[model samples]
Target: MLSYIYALAGQFQLTHERLSDMPAAPPVLLSDRQTEVLKWAAAGKSRGVTADIMNISEAAVDDHFRRIFKKLNCNDKVVAVLRAMSSGIIHL
Candidate 1:
């Protein structure tokens, strides 16, 4: 499972690198904790599991994802993870 995630991330990186000729989008800044949460999400962790691993409440985790969604202009966790990976915001 983890290897599959890594492979997907690798593909995103490769695709982005191949598009280097295009003008790059403005860098999207995320807090350290937000990045950490997205990393766990990229690892296929559930919200409760991510909260437990981070020693934060599930509500906190949800809040982080909400902010992440807004920042990434995404509405779903999977989309947010893909955007983050494509933008080199997080790695597997």
Candidate 2:
């Protein structure tokens, strides 16, 4: 799986800067689950649909959004997506 590959790769000497080419990118500090949730968010997925696809509860999806918003310092989803795009975490 992708998470397993990233985990295996993390055991080596490469650091965050080497992991991401963009200067404005945020540190690669998110957990795999968080990254997955963010990717879904970036794709314009609603909380309920994302939860169904991810096999998590709607409340769990809300919880992820709360953490994501706080972490990215975004007041809303639009700002979150913009911030994430600027940070090279995703492209739209």
Candidate 3:
């Protein structure tokens, strides 16, 4: 069971080097709201928690993540945050 779980998890893992290997695009410009959402996401907050903290709907939080992902050219939140920080787009 544990091996199966590990294999399943491995299928979804994204390494930092893999993310870095993506084309060196220009720094992505994010809206203020999207920046805030990215910060919350980096802190390991769930969509519902981020929504509450920002006083917005969960759907809005999801939308923000969608836009963030597109803007950052990353498929996952971790990669997006890493790229943002490395590109000087966000401090944290």
Order the candidate numbers by TM-score, best to worst: 1, 3, 2
Per residue, candidate 2 scores C-alpha lDDT tens digits across 1-92 of 86445434442313453467735535535556666777887787988899999999999988877887788765466556555665667766
Which model scores highest in lDDT? 1
Pairs in steric clash, model 3: none
Clashing pairs in 2: none
lDDT of each: 0.85, 0.67, 0.77
Per-residue lDDT of model 1, residues 1-92, tens digit only:
87567657656765775678876657899999999999998888999999999999999999999999999877677767878987889887
Winner on lDDT (1 vs 3): 1
TM-score for candidate 1, residues paired by index: 0.74
Query: How close is every model to the real structure, measured as TM-score?
Result: 0.74, 0.63, 0.73
Per-residue CA lDDT of model 3 for 1-92, tens digit only, reads: 86456434433443444456665577588999999998897787998999999999999988998999898766677767777776677785
Task: Assess candidate 3 and give its lDDT.
Answer: 0.77
Cα RMSD to the true fold for all candidates: 4.3, 11.4, 5.1
Once superposed on the true structure, which residue ranges of model 1 sit more than 4 Å away at CA? 1-24
The best candidate by TM-score is 1
